[model samples]
Target: MSNIIANQLDLFGAEEQSELFDEDAPTVYYHGDPDRVHARLHRLIAEARGAETLPWDQDSTRLYRKIVPQMVLWLPEEEAAQLRFEFEAELERMKAA
Candidate 1:
């Protein structure tokens, strides 16, 4: 009788033991190519500098405000700091206007 019940469970795809999560899984991060990132940051800086006022919509502005500084970290220390400073300065300039 027990063997028959086990066979029925097996036929129905029941598992006697299972884990809902795996703790040992490896985590992956994808940081884009440094030269590409640098170019993107430069373009963003140039666009902001060219604008007579804030260049992006409020949501886009907020997104850039939050991410640009963080993204700069993928660059060399000196370059990152320069880009971050330029981006922030432009934002402040636009806001003050």
Candidate 2:
């Protein structure tokens, strides 16, 4: 598991660049127990607002990757798509730059 996390961190790839978001959006509803996912999402959102890199490996990198996709299930479909698209686009831009 630790080895997997290290690999994920290596591929997380956004570490060297920061992407800026023009709007502040509340995290869509997440129906889960109070845990790291909730906190991490909030942190991610805040980072997005500040144009910072959103790190992976919360609890574990694999777990962090898993939680992000699951979170979309609780959001309105359009909002979920928009966020996903924007984030991916930024990551792509970062990778390119």
**Best of the candidates, lDDT:** 1
Clashing pairs in 2: none
Task: Give candidate 1 regions above 4 Å deviation.
Answer: 1-25
Query: Residue 60 deviation, candidate 2, in Å?
Result: 8.0
TM-scores for every candidate against the unseen true structure: 0.72, 0.39
Question: What would the per-residue lDDT of candidate 2 be over residues 4-92, giving only the tens digit for each residue?
Answer: 99779857456544343324645566376434544555566545445534344336444644556677556667766765565556544
**Residue 86 of candidate 2: its Cα lDDT?**
55
Which digits, one per residue and each the tens of the lDDT, describe model 1 over residues 1-97?
9999879877745454333244675676998788998999999999999997998999999999898888988899999999999999998988888
Each prediction's whole-model lDDT (CA):
0.86, 0.55
Candidate with the greatest TM-score versus the true structure? 1
